[model samples]
Structures are given as C-alpha cells and as structure tokens.
Target: MSSVPLSFEQLGSYSPMDFLTPHYRQQLHASLQYLQRPAGTLLLHKGERSLAQYYLLSGKVAVDAGPARQTFEGGSPQAHMPLNGSQPNPATVKALTDVSLFAVEHQLLERLLGWSQEAAYQVSSLGGMVEEQADEDWLARLLGTPLFGRLAPSHLHALLARFDYVEVEAGQRVVSYGEPGEHFYVIKRGRASISLPSAYSEQPALTLGEGEFFGEEALISGAVRSASVTMLEAGELARLHREDFVELVRPTLIPQISRNELARLSQQGSRKYLLLDVRLALEYRLGHQPESLNLPVANLRTHADSLDRDTSYVVTPEGGIRSELAVHLLNQLGFDAYLLGEQPPLAA
Candidate 1:
C-alpha cells in the first residue's frame, strides 16, 4: 500500500457500490476517509469478525485459507470485491505490496443501502402490504417527493395500502400510445424505455430505472398516452389506479414556494435552496431568476441525480404546466422541489 492519500471519488472503483442510490453514495462519500497502508500489514485475521468491508485499489494481498495461500492483485477485474466478506473471515490476509485500502463500516453501508427502511414498510395486517419483503423505503420515497411531502402521514400510509405489484418481463410493453391511462406505474426494479411512435421517434427517447415512475402525463392531463413504455429488463412494478391516484394524490402536489420564502431560504446559513428555471433555452436565455439553474423538464430526469440531496430546489416559472411537471418529477424522484411563484419580500 502506498502512503499517499486517496480521494472520495475513488469509491466508484469499489464493486457493489452501485447497490446504493446516488444520494446514498453521496452520503457515503462524505463519511469516507482516505487511507493507504503498506506491505506485511494484516488486512484481515482468520476467524475474526468483520465490522466493515475492505476494498483494495492498489497492490496485492495474499490470502491464507484452507490448505493453500492465494494472491489477489489490486487493479484486477475483481479487485473491488469485499475482502473477507464473511461476517467472520475464514481467511487471514496480508498485504504483499504497498496497498491502497478503504474500509466502510457495515452498519452505515447496510443502513444506507435501504435495509433499515424495510420495517417501516410493513403492515400490521396480512391483507394490506403486497410484499412484506418489498423495498422498505418505497412508500417513504414517494411521500418524501414534493407532492406528498406536506400530506398527513396517515393519509400517505393509507395511500400505500392501495398499491399493487406487477411483474414485467423484458420486451414487455407496459403501456402504449393512444391508450387511456388507467394506472400510474412506478418502477420497483429493472429498466424501461420510453418512446413516442406517433412523434416519429426512431429510438427510445427516455429510460427509467428503479424508483423512477411514468404514465403520469395521461393521468394528470386527462389525455391519451403520448408514448409507449417497454421493459428493458425483467423486473417488478408497482401501480396505482388512476382513480386512486387522483383521489389520494393530485391534492398533495400543492406545496408551493413564494418568491420571498425562497429568497429567504437562499439567504439562510444552514439551508441550501436553488432557484431552477425550467424553461426553453431561448426563453431562459432571455431572462430568468437571479442565480437560477436552467434544467428544462425535458432534460430533468437525465440530470436529476446530479443534484445534491442536501439542497432544496424551487422550480420556475410558476403555474406553467411545464414548470409544474418539472417540479413534480423532481420531487417524485426524491428531490426536495417546489413550484416557484413570487410574492413580495416579507417585512424584515
């Protein structure tokens, strides 16, 4: 191991890191400390319990397990696998060269991986929850979205009772153009391609993966479906009937930020708020909110994860369907977002 320092971005080199959501990864990166250790160091001792996972980014490690000693080289294809992943390591490992290692505590990593959220998703009775083993944060993630953020907890819990799970196979068509939207679908797992055949699109214009949702435009606009959704991978899905969506939802999407409240939040020392202008390039180029970032609704899903979870975004211009859609999409996708409108600054 080299004695040089490492950066948090290097965490991407670690395997299984993709199991974490972008927001969760950001949290882990913030908590991780850079480390480098040298040869002859005991990376793991045989039969010792592991409280954390170890990753090697450089150098070689010799493992003493069974009757033989095997060597693992850093920078190899599988170098990112957790070293001694078993709770009680069955092998003793020694550094063979100057090594770069990062240890992530199991507790924090598992918690951030959404395991802790599972218990919260359980139902007291057998009839309510579709799967007790479902993603624990599934409903919480929806409620955390801007639409339901202000909803009474009881109401959101009730809404959770209405969800149903559906398994989809790769190449399945989840929805089609010109169809009356009957349900709103949220991707529970797997990937899907979204494209509009009527629009003369030659390829999928958009794609959604886990925690992403679709079929809302028709539900919200009372219009026929504009696009077709096809599964890119076999996965589970959760759907809410349109009537349930309208009656239990729609109303919760009223969290709005007045111009002054936003400005005040932007000035607060602890709060980080951004004024987002979701207008066309030409319109935004003409004039926009001071210090606002321009991320059009058409491009929001692609760029949404790039946003830091610690910040709140106020999306403008207020009341435009485009802005409202952008706000809902951002909030629904786990961002702290609100429709932007202006009121005079409050009296100081």
Candidate 2:
C-alpha cells in the first residue's frame, strides 16, 4: 500500500487493485465500490459474516483482538489487507478518522483472482482434440464454459450421450450461410475456417482450431446460418441436433430478470449490473439505457469473446424474444448473462 502516494484523482493508486494486471482488474471494477466514511464508525465487527474485502485506503482504524487493541494508520502494513478476512471477523475494527476505502464482494474477488492467476499461466494445444486431452483438462474446459459449467455431472454425462460423431475432409463445408442451422458442432480433431459470405466471395474471418466449438449462432439465435465453416484439415466433430440441444441446454442457460430487480441491483453500487443494449448502432444511438454498451447484434458474437467473464451483463434489444436470444448466445460462451423481461409475479 505504501507504494502508491494518496491522491484524490487516482483511486486505483491507493487500491489493492493496483497490484492486479490491467485485464484482471477491469473484470473486478463492476463489482467493486469506493467509499468515504466518517470517523467513529465500526468498520467491522467481531463474529460478523465477512461479506466484503475492505481495504483502508486513507484512514485511521483501531482493531480490538480480544484483550489487545492496536491502531493502524493509513499506509501501514497492518491495514493492507481486509481486516478479519475469515468467515466471521475475529475482531472488531473502528474508524478513528474520516476514511476512504474500497470494498468488493469477498467471494467474487476470490473467484476472479483465482481465474486470473490460472488463465495467466495456462498453456493449451491449438491442435489437440477436445477429447484427447487428459480427463481433468477436457472436463474442466467443459465445466468452465458459461452454458455447461452449472450443469450437474450426471446431466453433462447424459448430454454427451446424445451426440453422434462424423469425420470431415479438408475443404468440406460444415454449414452454409442462408441455410437452416440444425446442429451444433464441437470439434474433436484438427482445424476449420469460419467465413461470412457477401457478394460473390466468402471472406474468411476466423479460424477454429482443435478443442474449440462452432455452429452455435444458428441454434441460439434461431436464424439461418450467419456464416459458414469449412474444414482446413481432415477432422472429426461431434454433432448435437437442435432439438436435443434446446431441450437439454437452453433452459438452464438463459435468465429473465425483472425491471425492478435490475433497478435494485443497479442501486446496490452501480458497479455489478451492465445493461447491454445490442441493437443496431443506429437504433442504439436513437435511445438506450444510461450506461448501456451499444454492441449491435450482428457483431455481438464476434465481440462477446472479449467481454470480461466476471461481470454480469443484462443483454437487451427493444424488449422481446430478441433480448432472450442475445442473452442465450452470450451464455453459451460462458458469459454471466441475464435478459430484461416481464412476467407476472407469483403469489406469495
């Protein structure tokens, strides 16, 4: 904490967030809050659930650990980490002066920190088949995804049972634009190229190597194929029919959140919920929610890969099934997604 000089203009300068890489810290920004509190406040209490990680950015605080009491001024090593990080705080902390602090949900901070550390060092093969990896690695990748991560092990096993296999040759078309999207394909071996067709030529836009997946756009959006995938090398793919995919995968992936609930979340700190408006650029420019990010639907699939997984996104269009479709697609890629919609309240 002493590394940064206290400055009102640079909140991050005094934050634990300063230690994290830019990419990792951006993911936590939505769930974190900055606060200024008056003196004489009990910043923390003994035996209270540790709901958040509190860092004393600029403050004087006293900690009572049983019979002993110690004072920690701002920038001291004793105040570097959250006080009483255990489930129930072991001691009480009281503010001795007006203080500035940063707080983030304890569980969220831990999860993102773990993921960031893991992802930072992870190395994977671009050519190894999905099923060829060690069981732990292969399964973890499946469970790490947004759509399948929450599924029970038993459900995942059952879902895998429904897939059938096929081998494709180099230059073979897996799916074509303007055709009905009837199946989702998970690559088992080799690589493929994804192209979007316009006029007389198909422009190659992405490459899908082994262990990656494709063909989700049609199923999630219920639209004709938006692009085509052709094998770049002889490959094997596991295919799941649209009906089976809908029955097994869609229900658990998409969420319908009410306006009031979204409002309540927004007021919590204005950092947790991002109301994403995925309409055309022109439509979004006309009118949209305050603070919403404008990403048109056509580009959503491409840009979704870059979004921070730690933040919760409420994807919306001019309210209808369109919003649901957008959220559903986001969920497939492991995004924390929810849709803004209306449904009658249940009787209490």
Candidate 3:
C-alpha cells in the first residue's frame, strides 16, 4: 500500500464515491491514494489483468474493447474493475489532460470489503448503480426505440447486463451507410440522429431523438447499415455488440416477427414476381426470404443483368435507410419494384 494519505478536502467539489453509500464512502477513504495523470494518457486497455480498482478523482479516461469504445470524463471518482480471465497487461494509459486518481489494488479492496460489513454494503450499493448506468447507456443509443413504458424490472435488468458502454461527442458519425453493421446502440445521455442520401432529390433525410434505436434489422441479420447515424449531443451510450446480441437478445426477439408477415412475402413467390432481398451479403446468409435473391442495394445496378426486366420485383431491406433507397434505385433502373413492409420512410 502506498503511504500517501487521502484527505476529504482533496476530493474537491466532486463526491468521493458518487455510487457509494455514506458508510462505504468512509471506509474507502481510509485505503486510497490520490495520484495525478497528464493528458493523452491511457488508464487501461482491453483484456488487461486485474489490478487495483481505480477511483477517478478528476479528468477523463477512455475504455476501448472490441466494438464497444467509450471515453468517460472522470468528473467524480469512478471505480475500475478488471474482468476475470487470462489477463493481458494494459496496452496503454496515455492521459488526455491532467488527471487525478485514487488507486487501490484489487486484493486490498477484496480484503477490506471482506473484513468490514459497512464496506461491503457500500460496495454492493455502488455496484447496483454501476449496473443501472449500463442500462441507461444502452437505451440512449437506439434509433427507432420501442415503447419502454411497460418494461418490467427483471426484464430491464437482463437487458442492462448485456450492454457495453460507449461515449461520443456531438457531430461524430457513429454509423455510416453502406458499411457493415456490427453493433446496435442506445443513448444514455445526449442525442443523435439518422442521415440518408436522398434518391429522388438532392435533399438528405434526417431524424433525431433519445431512446430511439437505429440498425435493429442489421443487428439481427448481419447486414450493412442502411443509413448513417451521427451524434447530435455529446454524451455517453451503451451498445450491444453482435456476439452478445445473438446469445442474449436474438432468441427472445426472433419469435416476435409475425408468421403472417412471413407468409405474405412467401405467397408472392412466382416467375412474374421476384423477391429481391436488399440486405447485404452477410445478412442475406444469416436468414432471408427463401426464394429471394441476395442482391445488396449497393450492388443492384451492377447485378442488373441477373434479373429479368419483365419480372415484378419486391424490395425488402432490414429497416430505415436501405429499403427506401432500394425502392428508389430499382425504379430508376426501370424495374417495377415496391417495398414489402410498412416502416418509417427512409431518412431524407
């Protein structure tokens, strides 16, 4: 343990442990060291071995792992807990600016909490708050949000655990159209909007809000993004990457697609009426209309020869940007094409 003693005065205007109870806060203060870090520094990296649980005193830190990357402003002290596994040392801890931190080794924390009931209670409470934060973060990134008015606590808790936190500033493009969609996002704080290139005219389509989630279709089907999503407000977000999504959320969601909708599209299968799945190649492989040809909207023009001009085509894309754009594209090519399902108009 470092000999540097902690003073309540040094905690500045920020709460010592915003996530902890008063009793636990007192316990934590007894066993922490306050250290300062400079800008452009990395505090931790993905797949690092467990170390001390760091409580940020001041400044900011970025946590990057796989498809979930976020930067957190350590306005108040926040704890850092390493995941259990084959621990790789951190890749970097470069500072973004001058930073102040309170460090406590993991073993020391376990021992302290193990010995003190008050400490344990406080830590547990803090843990609950951390978990809540994760949920809020996830909901904020969605583009077309479901009505969450009736979600149960148990259901909400299950959803929260699967999300990874992301942070972005205003004017940043989170997802771009014509790129592979790998994850879905929900906002925790701030705001974002969807943007699409206009086909009929030069005007672009745009929509903005919190709680709304875009890219739901791509997330399920492994398709390319149908539109671009950009942050309109600077804040935090929670994301569910593709792997976690498939294991945790997909099974529950797949059953919700009505059988009637499936049959309606299937009934259209014939020589005169062709099903053109406008989803990307990877998405088409995941699952699609059995009789539909996998011609992604981007490559539709190039692959025009594959389709007969006399055939009436049905354009079906996952959601938002892709389907509408596809309908417009096929029309430009002089194919009698119509979108299959009812949904929000393509972003302007």
Write one digit per residue (lDDT tens) for candidate 1, span 150-237.
5554555677688888989999999999999999998877889988775465544788877677887777767789789999999988
lDDT of each: 0.69, 0.67, 0.54
Answer with 1 or 2, whichever has the higher TM-score.
2
Query: Ten residues in a row with the worst lDDT in model 1?
Result: 117-126
Against the true structure, what is each candidate's TM-score?
Answer: 0.49, 0.56, 0.34
- Model 2, 1-348: lDDT tens digits are 222433433434534556654544654664456667679987777876554777777879888979999988776766666776666777898989888777776655555455445442332322234433442343345444555544544445566778777889999999998999899887766689988777525434689765567777677768898788999999788688999988887666666667776765555342476778777777777767666787766566768668887677887647455676778777766666788775433212
Q: Mind giving the per-residue lDDT tens digits that candidate 3 earns over 263-339?
A: 43344221256767777777777767556777777787667777787666776556335665565556545555656
Candidate 3, position 186, lDDT: 66
Ranking by TM-score: 2, 1, 3
RMSD versus native structure for model 2: 8.5
Query: For every candidate structure, what is the RMSD over all alpha carbons to the true structure, in angstroms?
Result: 13.7, 8.5, 24.4
Ranking of models by lDDT: 1, 2, 3
Highest lDDT against the true fold, candidate: 1
Enumerate residue pairs that collide in model 1.
1-97, 1-98, 1-99
Candidate 2 residue spans exceeding 4 A from truth: 1-138, 147-154, 199-204, 270-274, 277-296, 299-312, 317-319, 328-336, 343-348
